[model samples]
Target: MKSNNTLTFSRRNFIRTSALASGGMLIGFNFFTACKDKVAPPVDISQLNFNNFNAFIKIADNGIVTIFSPNPEIGQGVKTSMPMIIAEELDVAWKDVHVAQGILDTKNYQRQVAGGSQSIRFGWDALRQTGATAKQMLVNAAAAKWGVDASSCSASEGVITNANGDKLGYGDVVKEAAAMEVPENVKLKDPKDYKIIGQDIRNVDIDKIITGKPLFGLDYTAEGMQYASVLRPPAFGQKLVDFDDTAAKAVTGVSEVVRFGDKIAVIASNTWAAMKGKKALKVNWQVDSKLENTADHDKILMDLLDGNSFDTRREDGNVKKAFAEADQVIERTYESPFLPHNCMEPMNFYADVTADKVHLVGPIQTPAGTARRVAEMLERNVDDIHLEMTRMGGGFGRRLYGDFVMEAAEVSNLIKKPVKVVFSREDDMAAGIYRPAIKYRIKASIKDGKVTGYHLKEAAINSNMYGLIPNFFPAGAIANYKVDTANYNSNITTGAWRAPYTNFLAFAEQSFFDELAEALEMDPVQLRLDLLQNVKGTTDERIQYSGERMENTIKLAAKKANWGKKQDGVYQGFSAYYSHNTHVAEVAEVVIKDGFPVVKKVVVAVDCGIVVNPLGAKNQIEGGVIDGIGHAMYSDFGFNEGAPEHTNFNSYQLIRMNQTPIVETYFVENELSPTGLGEPALPPAGGAVANAIKAATGQRLYKQPFIKYIGMEEQELIG
Candidate 1:
């Protein structure tokens, strides 16, 4: 079922022997491992096969370059930002470059999964190192032709320049360069000398996206491709029992309806037909009444938190003893709910399988991981499984799972034809792996208007956050005495979503500090400054934040937001947290509208190393902030009979344009390596907004989905 129109880049195989490949569907140029030696070949645009292109790029006989990315692009602007890393150091003009998704090759591209705000951070070294090698090899080849010293020729702006000012384009010398060996030690550009990095660049895919060029998985169609709609388990752990496919086959355009194990699939000629078929198909839903998670799930979580499964994330002094001696001890418990990714485009993928090969494509974030799973499922060599990633609608860590990929590949294998699996908004909501619900019990001791001890005892699944680090952000400088965790197992499985544990930890920690600030009659900003001023510069690997960056972001956000300046009728609250290798500080200002507090404005300060694309970077931060607000104030994860409570936008809530407040962002000046932006901003938004709610209503919220527990939701189902 491979698209006949796909281009064959056999020339690429002719050159680099060290290329590791991953699944990619369409778009981009190929990036080979270039060391101090030559790479496989330069990209030649004229040779491009636009219609039926293999995922990884191939260039020959010219200086054209190709790039195939394996992750889905769900409105994080990854289609442009991720490729910029390769184009930057490759010394290629933006006009001369083309990008594509890889044709599911895993040997060269490992960790093709995209989450944890890790794309740039991970590509920081590998892609640059490869690009430098390619540039060096090009220079070396030109030097050989001119019969001059290698040092006498330098590569710049896609051309090799000799000391005498003679120039040869990268394309001109690519053939000879391809024949050269990869260099052992290629010099990386110093930040000061960077030509493309650390500079403001517009998102490259902006034009394509605006023009509506079938860029996502839903847009993918093979000549004989069919549509599929999966009827999943009604509830977690429930298996399929029996179904009648007669009605489904009678649906217009429906070709086949099959049941495999516990799931059923409806295959049809079009999306409309497949959906209609699913609605018409009737089945005995062996609704298991035993171990009903929707009813008992949240209660189980509450019990776990109430019990002694506590792990210490941070502790200073002896909280219990300090509380006994304290003139005032403020203790509060905070709870957060499970929420769906609810990305606008929903989850989708297309796959074609045969005994010889399997081709998978869609809006997937973890293509390499998908390839591995597909290879395992089909008993095929990992190298033989190909994957293509699509630009996503909105990925708040939803696409991070390779489950969708596996489902597509499995279905394709059963049908032995190309099929695209589409998840409806309902399917995506019900099928999604949700953000874990968590509880925080914060304890603090204050005496004589001075802080002495702070302890945060948090309980969660603990397995969600880790491994997005290029290197750890040093936070040891902060006066934190201890951090630990306790775990619990549940029937519903969970994984990473944005910043993982940091999201819960920051909301609880920062908000608790605000409470202490009010108790001591001190400014929240001043208290944080007092605590943070003692530390500067990056902490070692032992800690997770740059104490200096923390202080800087706090100061900048405070100064810009006017923390102490009183507004006649408005209330303000502040919060700051460091995660994703990015330190973010935010302030939320709001006022009561009718009965509920509505945010009026937000000010943020960020330090994500260097801002590669200011517009793009700022956009990510803004979106993160809004996402955080929705989760804290309204995004509730409830269960009814062991199933997720909300199934669509109607029951669930999302902050929209009218709800978005004016956002102001500032970046740090120093050139540090890039960190993550997608999730760090999210954690603090909830805290900032929660703090504002306290200011506006004189009531502190100790629970997530703030509206639900803030005397908002009806009590009928809350119990």
Candidate 2:
């Protein structure tokens, strides 16, 4: 990929229009790029190391610029995007710079966890301001040396140039810049001056990633590092009744086959040896004879349709009155099965444990949480456990759980040596912590060809990935709404995957809207727009959403897609969801082939505030669309007689290159502060694809894994 300077200069015009700023001096100044004082004043930047030259910046005589961002890059591409925000404002050639992943430093970097689509927006102002402040200090140093007014000097491309264009390199002025007092206030660069942020830059680490350099935890290997493999019961809470490790102990390269509590592990010289030894070790599981099958989870969820739930998240008026007055009512039940994260790289962590301290390295999403947990488990201070985050093969939010890390710590402690615990596909899938199998009861009232009311009730195993957002509970996405939920304690362990509840939300809400639109005889997009025109909140009441913004995104996406204009045999479906402080709308075009929804194209429009890295933003939207489509259309988890039904990729399907659709991502020009990008885009795609399938077959399929709703092998044979 030719990542040259041409794209950098073109982005200046992007900021020129996006920032809507004026004046050449403001444009030339690095501090003026982000323009934060519109509805709110600039956040106080004093008395913090966030923008400190030594903390975020390290200048080299060779002109290599490093901007440290304290966030993990879980395939959303913020690793490259956030740094671009600073480099663009600094007016430096992007190629001359590199972005260093900021470690577990809370004071220097705010909220380092990169789950929501927030990486770029989170760093937008702070980093730009940091760069601008550094530039101001440098210019001041030059002005003092040249005996000219500070205002007489301007900054351009890592250099402070005087009015006559007399230039001084940033490296020459850095020592002086470091000594100056931090600026109380500095004018940010007008967007017209941006040389990096808006441009489509290639990924910063793609070269290392593609060249097979060690970028992910699975690829990490250290000298004196022993390997380990875990053997947990196939069922969620099943325990070991008995085990014989005679074969495992005799296997080549195997050191010890030991049981840590009920779970067993094989420690060896290599991952293969550990895996082979684990398979060789025989174990008997004490099955829960009375355990409820997943089908029972389905029944309990369906039983909640009678309206027994929390009624926790609500903000709208009487939905009963709205539905009562409506000309027609459309009701549907949506169901999604428990899904394994199946992150391309199975769960793995490398840890070196000694009596005094432990060092951990791997693809972990929540470094702070992991650090906290690891410290507690090790009975050491938090500072004693150093967490180094690796670029994840993929994190649909599965890595958020630190089980693999804990396993590594356990193995190291048991053997008193540094050990790496790597999960094979079988180990990863069989381990619980799946997206909970859940169900939703959605009812909508339509009058005069528009949606008038919505009553949504969802039930699932509580305490799943991302238990609940502070304000927007499950029922927060629509108005004239009555939202309720109930948690049925299951033996299964669950955690966040991609968009979390978004998986079911897309299916339930979007599918209901589709049915309602059909009953009202209105276009799905038009009906959604009309409803949102008056639809106040994501959760109703205090958890309201900006209807204007939602309407704008739908409209922009429709216009870009040329809705109802093109001749597409493939059906197109649309859905929008607001979570993690961002509004994302997606349109998925799907082809129903023998009950399978083949997603062909994805059109996405997002508003997460200022666009940081256009390339990263696009990559995230694309990846999310593909990831969600996979789960919605094919992914499933089953249980047979209290045992997990699937072990690896063979049983659990995923959306791959042959199945990935052509994704067209368009970022709505906004400067809203950052929100999560990692999982937000995915949740909405579920509904979009389901809606497209509805368009294709004049049928409302409420159950998930689109494969199930259409006709499973058992169902078709029975029918």
Candidate 3:
């Protein structure tokens, strides 16, 4: 799985061939090209149609190449970037390439999920081979026509040419190529020769998106389809006791009221009517578990951190001995509350279930997994379920759950009709799969002006950070490093939100570094550089971050922001982090305005390998930084007896446009395969802003939603 050959089309057995009735060439290949356990389907050259193509590539007679992007696109630009990888190797003109979103085809695709920002990274080699293999077949066909050696014939911009200057369009010889044997090995383009990649390609759906066309799940409609609005328990620990739907049935356009498990669904001809009818229904609920509150969670997390019973994630040396011998031990505890994803389009899914087949179409991050779940719930064959993906307004890890998809499928199965389930803003917020509330206590022992010991303890709700995270950054630098984690199982649901644990962890650790620098009487940027230098040549596999890349990123951000040189009224703070296979550094500029800190600008430096599309990459970076800053400064969510305090935007405070600072981005140039860009840039922004606020107001923020401690004294806020 690491090499290009293993990803796709290294041997003839991995290729699938078919003929086009229009005399064009079609190439299909499995993503798991080197998997020995699975067998590829036999080639069928007699199938004379384009519909039989396995959602990979379709070459038309007009020399236009259609590449299917086989990954869910949640506004991360994979729908455009994934196909760009194929077209780059296909040697087709960017103008002649038509990008399309592929359906969930587990037969030919792998890792179709959209979370983790890994679509481009994982699909890079496979997609390149897919296009290269087809190009080789075309070249072979063209060489046969001229009776010349196939090696002398090369393809570029959808044309095949020989050494004698004989030119033929790919379409002109596609018919002959359809009959040719699949090529076992094909030459890929060198990164220096790339024509379509590393270019600013606009989003493929930009036109439709700007014109407000039907490109999102909410815009989907079907014949005789009913819209549904569901009502679940208002509180996390509540369960359904009884319900009365008479008022709902009397509402206009109300068709049916069906109760399933602990929820009730109101079906109607339109979304508004369904929502209105659902509001009219009366239901009773009983507490099924302890109604935990924010105060209770805070106490529990503190107790867990103070207790000795914990899982040791990573321990490098004797932390206890290092701490005992230290001259100074600086300790700080950071806390963050649960947060909602609050996707722009809310949650909605369309499902049409029948005895014969089940049709589903919606914006889902995990379409293949959702389909299997639906199939299991309906007790139908997985092959009988057909699901389609639409462009999502925004996911940020919310759509990965697919709970709304299950609701739609279940409702359709019960009503025996096509149904689309939609969640109100309140429902989306109150009944969300939230980011787990977490607290981290980081202690650094400084001896002889050098860090000798580091210990981090994490207490979380529901789940802890992934095991691999404990190995990232400073884990190899500190000689006596130790990481411990413990979790409290809560009835309230929690799951991945954007960058997950790193979103808040970065702020905690990076802020601690700034404090450590202050205690050592050293510059913060120089302190990070020195730490990275400690692990520069180490060969320890446990360390996940690249010290060289992280050091370069930190230098770039510091140089751009003029790290130590200060302006009269401006204060700056620096933070650097590595996450999701990307290295990022940020510097936040803050100024005091009427006794309040105002963020004026942020300068970001990233090393995510090669840039696929600069425009799209910049968008991701800027969006992440703004989102991180917004949440860290303004957004706050708390639970009162298992009920969310803020259920809508009115109560939930988000950073306003006027408050958003200007962001400048710079990327390191390299030939390495592209890594994720969507979430890596976010984790460092919070840390940068927190450190900046400290410089501006002499206040150290240990809790999220920095606004809570805005006017309070440092001692009062810390206490």
Error of 1 at 719 (Å): 12
Candidate 1: tens digits of C-alpha lDDT, residues 1-719: 11121112333332231221221111222333211112112223333333212223333335566665544555655556666666676677766677665434554455555677876775555555556666777788899999999998887778889999999987677667756765666666666666666566676667777998887778888989999998887676566778888988999999998776688889999988998899887877665554344335556555765677555444444556766777987767776766677887888888899877788878777777778878898788976776666677766677878777777888888888899999999888888787766666656677777665555555554333421221222123333334444455555556667677677667777788888888888888788877665455533445566666788888889899888797877899899988877889999999888887899889999988866667788889988888788677777766665577778989788777788788888887666667787777888888898888888888777777787777553233223
Residues 475-581 of candidate 2: C-alpha lDDT, one tens digit per residue? 44344666656677777777776676666776677777766767777888887777664445343456535676777888877778777764657787888877766
TM-score of each: 0.85, 0.87, 0.95
Quote the lDDT for 520 in model 2: 72
Report model 1's TM-score to 2 decimal places: 0.85
Off by over 4 Å in 3: 1-9, 32-55, 105-110, 464-468
| Most accurate candidate by lDDT | 3
| Clash number for each model | 61, 27, 0
C-alpha RMSD for every candidate? 7.3, 7.8, 2.8
Indicate the worst ten consecutive residues by lDDT in candidate 3.
Answer: 34-43
| Best candidate (score: TM-score) | 3
